[model samples]
Target: MPAPTEMPTKHSTPYPTWEQFQQMEKRQDALEKRQDTTDRRLDSGAGEFAEIKKAQDTLRQQQAAHGQTVAEVREILAELRELVESFGNLKGTIRVMRIAGDVIRWGCTLGAAALGLWVAFRSLGGGL
Candidate 1:
């Protein structure tokens, strides 16, 4: 078998010489430091994300409570509507009863007047 002229790599090699290899190492070290910094930032961001999630949950609970309050208000309004209708009906009944009482009072007064007139005519010797 013939000796291969170059080494094979899994990835394309941009650094084929000694100086290029040294430069590649420097770039790799820089990239590793940047990646560490990024990881630290992400760790701190996770705490913020947790707080955001908690706030969202609280907001959802408050919304549900407000919905219950609205439902209760609607129920109260319906009850009030019924009460108002009952009150109006009672007013009409009172008016009818008052008119009937007036009629009865006037009828009694007129009857008493007619009886007194008849008694006076009888005492004056009028026909029975």
Candidate 2:
């Protein structure tokens, strides 16, 4: 007969000793602790994922609002461009009117001077 500590021969299967069973129980306890830690991390990760999803939705809404704001800004810019063009045309018309008024004023001044000279000449007996 072989002692319990001796290696098994080819014909017989070996059974675990008391020490080996205790080591296996300790390893099982460590594995269960590691599994519990992993499960806690996974639960926290699920919460983080929900937070990230909420933030993404908020960003999407902000992006849509920004798009609308950009469109409104473009529209305002277009209207401002049209107003600038209209102001340019109005400036030209004002310039033309000012030139016409200057010409008329000068014509009236020259006519008044000529009439004064004619009156002085006729009174001095240099009639035409």
Candidate 3:
């Protein structure tokens, strides 16, 4: 019996022409350009967000200052109210003192006049 002969193997090769290589390069360049544009937009958005955060911080600080100012004003108003109340009490005391002084003065004057009349009656020999 004769031995079987082996079949010959075929080798494969890829051949890319110059025009095809140029087209691929152009496509890659376009893709890179689009990616760069997208990256720039992302960076701009991030910067804008940072600015907004700074503005929010400034607003919070201003609000805190305003709150402190309001508290101070309230304290001042309370003190003023207390002062006014004290002044009113003082005025009432002064009015009461004035009324008492007037009463004492009138009582003393009437007593002196009555004593003088009694002395005159005695000197004229009037009966007790």
Candidate 4:
């Protein structure tokens, strides 16, 4: 009987063709390019986000300033109201003074008329 043919053992390393090696190199280069583009996009987006945050901060500061202005206006209004009230009181005081002056003038006129009548009656020989 013939001896059984032995099957060849499989080789440890498979030889890659030159075309396969070039294809792998190209794929690696494309992957590196994609990564670089992604990094640049992330950097640009971060810069834009920072600008937006700065704008938001500025807006908040402006709002705070506006609030302060409103508060100051309210204080000024209160002061104006106080001044108006004092002015009203002064007007009332002036009105009372005018009335009192009129009363005094009337009293003086009546006293003078009575004195004149008395003097005339004495001159005419009438008893006091």
The TM-score values for the models, in the order shown, are: 0.68, 0.70, 0.57, 0.65
Q: On a 0 to 100 scale, what is the lDDT of residue 58 in model 1? A: 100
lDDT of each: 0.91, 0.93, 0.88, 0.89
lDDT of 4 at 39: 95
Higher-lDDT candidate of 1 and 2? 2
Instruction: Put the candidates in TM-score order, highest first.
Output: 2, 1, 4, 3
**Candidate 1: segments with Cα more than 4 A from true spot:** 1-25, 118-128
Q: How displaced is residue 41 in candidate 4, in Å?
A: 1.9
Worst 10 residues of 4 by lDDT: 1-10
Candidate 4, pairs of clashing residues = none
Give the Å error, residue 65, model 1: 1.0
1 or 4: which has the higher TM-score? 1
lDDT of 3 by residue, 1-128 (tens): 22245443332224446777899999999999999999999999999999999999999999999999999999999999999999999999999999999998888888888888989998999968
Runs with alpha carbons beyond 4 Å of true place in candidate 4: 1-16, 115-128
Q: How far does residue 91 in candidate 3 sit from its true spot (Å)?
A: 2.7
Residues 42-105, model 1: lDDT tens digits: 9989989999999999999999999999999999999999999999999999999999999999
**Better TM-score candidate (1, 3):** 1
Runs with alpha carbons beyond 4 Å of true place in candidate 3: 1-26, 104-128
Model 1: clashing residue pairs? none
Off by over 4 Å in 2: 1-17, 107-128
